[model samples]
Target: MKILIIDDEAKAQSLLKKLIADLSLKVDQLFTANNLLEGIDIIKKEAPKIVFLDIEMPEYSGLEILDHIDLEQYPFKIIFTTAYQQYATEAFKLSAVDYLLKPIDPDELEIAINKALKIIEQNRLSSQIKSLQNALNELKVKKIALEVPHGIIFAEPDEILYFEADGMYTNVILKDQRKRLICKPLKHFVEQLSQNKFFFKPHRSYLINLNYMTEFIKKDGDYILLDNTIHIPISRSRKDDFTALLRETFL
Candidate 1:
């Protein structure tokens, strides 16, 4: 696969290179650009199969390139490399395979790569482009899963209320008064799940299902409740972000 790195950060660029090298993945070639203009130039020349794009730069932003680029003209799959927590929806809008948060984890990188491969192999260029746009607009689908005694207890994605971390376990709360214990860590699933505007991370330990949210409460700290029944704590670090995301998705 041919890949392009579009970022202003030298460290980030090198890190991605190291990741590919470490994995010994088959990449025919990799082209790097310091800014969007150079990135676009390389895109035209290389016509890479995948683009690893960073959102913030002095010369240009990731979204701007997405807005300007022609889907048919450049048929590469997109994988968003961002430091911001807020661009999850934006990534999906570009039909991005997955969003890699900064200080990128190797596990997260692996998951993103898997998702990207599936999207490109199964979808047409137009669909890929439209999905990316959908991320900026509104997420099309809400996927909810439940876990029982064994493993991932199958439940409709739409039936979930919220997710809360109980020590190491993440609970998938359903509207029908049942809570499913997801075996995997919340962070692990979040990286793999498709982008959804309604599903907001109110706290590091909690991933809220917006479909069930009925009230937002702010006091000494920030926290949210679903249907006025399920209460989840919002850590101090994520309080401001939680509020902002709530406003963006609901208000």
Candidate 2:
């Protein structure tokens, strides 16, 4: 794997470089840049698989490097390394992507490398549909908070089984078959979740989980069955769109 480090601190880079070598990491290539522009140049030139991005830099920051995103250009994994503690939560909210505080931790570097490796493996494995998958992955919603009968529970994107519109409320059904009532209305939830996962509103009252869908067949008049018997009637307005999505995912 090719790795790029973008930091102005020479000592920090040197220490990280030594750790990279000491760990005997599987880095096929390594590139270094002192600032965001230089980093962007290296990224475009080398096309490294992993980036050690710094949040703060002269002129431009790491996020500014992505000011005008060309989605096709970003196949790399980013493990943010920074002295700033303020940005950790923001990075995590972006995804489950890892962040390392300076001075860097050797174990954290190892873990980040492992995570990047797994992603690389997935990239190779899904090469056929990578373009589509990556686009969808970017659309994945951030952490969703739900209000349960007891207080509130956080819902990660992956934990969702499906969502159902219950009158004014939206129920988020988790993978464990547990249901949590979202504080927002169904329309609000739908707009917020309009990315990533293969969720579709086949019916006005239901947003079916494309991942959990065992089967989608006609059952009980005009109703569509999510599985063998979980029926959700298709709304006329959304029927065509839902059908196309299902076709794109399956066929």
Candidate 3:
């Protein structure tokens, strides 16, 4: 595997190189670029599989480089490195993308590298890169890129009825009564969509979209009825908060 590090600071570049070298990752070529222009040129010439990008640069920000690349033609996994904590949310908006805080932790770096390698090997890079670009550019309605057996599927938050835990994977129920078994855990959806007011987790195994909810039934152990007449149970612990949220949002 080939790896490229794009950061203006010499210290940052050296640290990353040393860390990778010390860990003995299966990197055939380790390239470095000080600026966005140099990084772009090197990417065109070398075609590295993974890029460790720094958000802040002298001439151009790391995000600006995405605008220049044709993701479909040259698909590469990007692991963002930044000093700012605020950018974490933005970085995570991109499906399968990860961010490492400055003075990078070795454990976190290893995890990110392994995840990138797995995603690349599965041939899911192009869709993930496209999803990342879309997430970064838009904000009104978020689109989630779900990895299925064949490939990727893009779905809007409002279109989802609920998410059910299926062991390691998640079962996504849509408003049109279609179900997709995604290769992600229900907790993953909870973490990613929890920020949106319309999504909530009433139980450990379920993440329900409040927008698709039709009725809140308290008689039979506090379960909520969805648009398609699907009854999702609310955990005893979460029932109070769920009812409170329903009251605050609806009545």
Candidate 4:
């Protein structure tokens, strides 16, 4: 496998390279480019399987790469690297685009690489990039992409009742009483939906949208009842925080 890293900062480039090495990915060739144009040139010539692209470039943002390269023709997965925070980062999650925040963590890098491999195999990179571009340009995105075995599900955040962990998979329960089993784990959703204030992880095995929570039971066990009439337990450690959040929201 061939991999490329594009970033203006030499330090960032070096750090990512070291991290990739630490992860021990099966990379036959590892390329680096200082800027977007250079990265484009490398892409055209080398055709790496994966590209760790820096979004905040001097001349062109990483999204601008879409303007240069025809993704349909040159189909390679992109793992965006960005220093942008809050709103901008939210767009990435909403679009189901893989991104690493600045001062990247090794675990995130590993996860992103694994995801890119799966997407490349499924040949679903083009639509994801299009959605990401639209989200960044518009600066507001309400829907999120959920990857399942058959295909991807694009759904509004409010439509989700809660996420339940089933070992390696996550069961996403919708308002319409549909359960979509996702390939990724619950922890992935927790991080992806962290910015969405309504979603709360009351237990390690589940993440629930607070808006769907209809009742809280304290006598029998710490559990929350959602509008869908499903009981989700609140972890002992998270009980105080969950109660406080409920008070803050309803009070």
Alpha carbon lDDT of each predicted model = 0.77, 0.76, 0.87, 0.85
Q: For candidate 1, which ten residues in a row score worst on lDDT?
A: 136-145
Instruction: Mark the 10 consecutive residues where model 2 has the least summed lDDT.
Output: 220-229
lDDT of 4 by residue, 61-161 (tens): 77677878887677678888888764355436434348788889899889989998887766657777888897784443377779999999988888999
Model 1 Cα lDDT, one tens digit per residue, 172-239: 77778876777767885566453666677767777777788777788755667788887877788877
**Per-residue accuracy of model 3 over 1-251 as CA lDDT, tens digit each:** 88999999999999999998888588899999998889988889998999999988887988777677876677788899999988777666654368999999999999999888888877766778889888875663478888999999999888899999999999998889999999998888887886788899999999989988888887968898999589999999998898789789888
Highest TM-score model number: 2
lDDT of 2: 0.76
In model 1, the clashing pairs are 93-132, 93-133, 93-135, 94-132, 95-131, 95-132, 144-157, 147-153
RMSD of each: 18.4, 14.5, 17.3, 19.7
lDDT of 1: 0.77
Candidate 4 C-alpha error for residue 239, in Å? 82
Q: Clashes per prediction?
A: 8, 0, 0, 0
Ranking by TM-score: 2, 3, 1, 4
Better of 2 and 4 by TM-score: 2
**For every model shown, what is its TM-score relative to the native structure?**
0.48, 0.49, 0.48, 0.46
TM-score between model 2 and native: 0.49
Better of 1 and 3 by lDDT: 3
